[model samples]
Target: MSKPITKTNNWVLGLTGGIGCGKTAVSNMLEELDVTVVDADIIARQVVAPNSDGLNAIIEYFGQNILLPDGTLNRAELRSKIFTNNENKEWLNALLHPLIRLKILTDLNNATSAYVVLVAPLLFENNLDKYCNRTLLIDVPIATQIERTAKRDNTSIEQVKSIIAAQMPRNEKQQKADDILNNDRNLSLVHTELVVLHKNYLQYALQNTTNAP
Candidate 1:
C-alpha cells in the first residue's frame, strides 16, 4: 500500500551491503512495498550492452577477445580479466562508473515515489552514497559473506576472499549506514524488521515534508 500523502517530495535512498549480503533481496522487498527502485548493476549492464559506446570503450581498452562471436560482451571473459588484473579492474571501473552514474541520475530524477531505493554494491567505494539522502545497509557477518559467496557463486574460497577484499570492510559499511537491515536470519524475521522500518520511514517522510518549504 502507498504511504499516506504528505508534503515530502521524494527521497533517494542508497541501499548497499558487502558481497553476499542480500542487497538484491532487500531491493526487491522495497519494490514490493511500492517504493521505486533503481538498480546500479542493471544500469551498468545496459550501458555496456553490445554496440553501445561503453562496449566500444571496453573493447579499445581490453581488446576484442572479450566479445563473443555474436559481438556481445562475454561477461565471463570480462570478469576474468578484471578479477585477475588489478589495472584492468581499475580501467573497467573508470570507464563504467561515470556512465552508470549518469543513467542512475536520470532514473532517479524521474522517480515518482515518496522515496526511491538505489541498490549499489559499491555505493561507498564509488562514493555514490553522497547522492542519497539516506543509506540502507544489509548487514551480514564476514564469515557468512565468505561462505554464502563461495556456495552461491560456486567459486573457491580464495576467489571469494579476493572479491570480498575488493569491497569496503563490513564494519566500515555498517558505520556509514543511516539505517541497517540485518539479513543474517530467515526471511520471516527480515520481513518483520522491514515492516517496522517502513512505518518509521513513512513517519520520517511525513515530518520532512511538513517542515519543507
Candidate 2:
C-alpha cells in the first residue's frame, strides 16, 4: 500500500509542466538554489536500465527490435514507435507507471534534505500530486512550447504538438499549482521567482509537523 501524505519536517515539492514547458530549466535553477531535486524522468530511465525487471518487461512486450545488440533498450527506436502509434503509447504507459511510482515513493521516503523536489512532466495526470506539500508548474505559451521543443529536439511542430496532446493541458496544470513560474520571457525573472519559492518553502517546511494539514 502507498504511504499516506502528511505534513513533515521534510518539504516535498512537485514540479510539473506540459511538454516543452521548460520544466528542466526551472528544475536546474531549483537545484542551484540548493533544493534536493528528484527527477521522475531520470528515475524512469534508471528503473528500466539493462538487466532490470522494468527493462525486461518492456522487452517482453515489444521484443528484441526495441533493444540494442549490446542488450540496452533502443530508446530512440522505442520513442519513434510509441510516439507515432496510439496503441503502442498506452501499452508503454501501462508497462511503466506502476514500477515508476513504486521507485519514486521509495526514494522520496528516504530523502533527508530540507525539501525534495519531484520533477514530473505528468505530475497531475499520474495522480502523484497528492503526495506533494506544494505543487509548482513551469508554464509557457503553446506557441512557445511548440517552437522551443522543435528547436531543441530537432523535431517538427506537429510532432511536438502530438506530445503536447498526450499531456494534461497548461490551464489544468496552472489551476493545480501552488506556485507558477512563467519562463517564456526573461530568464532572470524565473530565477527571482525561485528565490521567493525557496524562502517560502523553507518557512513552510519548518512549521510542518506530522499533524499539519
Which stretches of candidate 2 lie above 4 Å from their native place?
1-9, 76-92, 210-213
User: For residues 22-69, what per-residue lDDT tens digits would candidate 2 score against the true structure?
Assistant: 888888988887777888999999888999998998888888888999
| Backbone steric clashes in candidate 1, count | 0
lDDT score, candidate 2? 0.85
TM-score to true structure, per model: 0.86, 0.86
Steric overlap count per candidate: 0, 0
Q: Name the candidate that leads on lDDT.
A: 1
Local accuracy of candidate 1 as per-residue lDDT tens digits, 1-213: 964322223667889998898988888888899989999989988999988999999999889998999999999999999877999999888888778887888788778877777899999998888788788899999899999999998999999998899899888988889999999999889988988887777777677678878
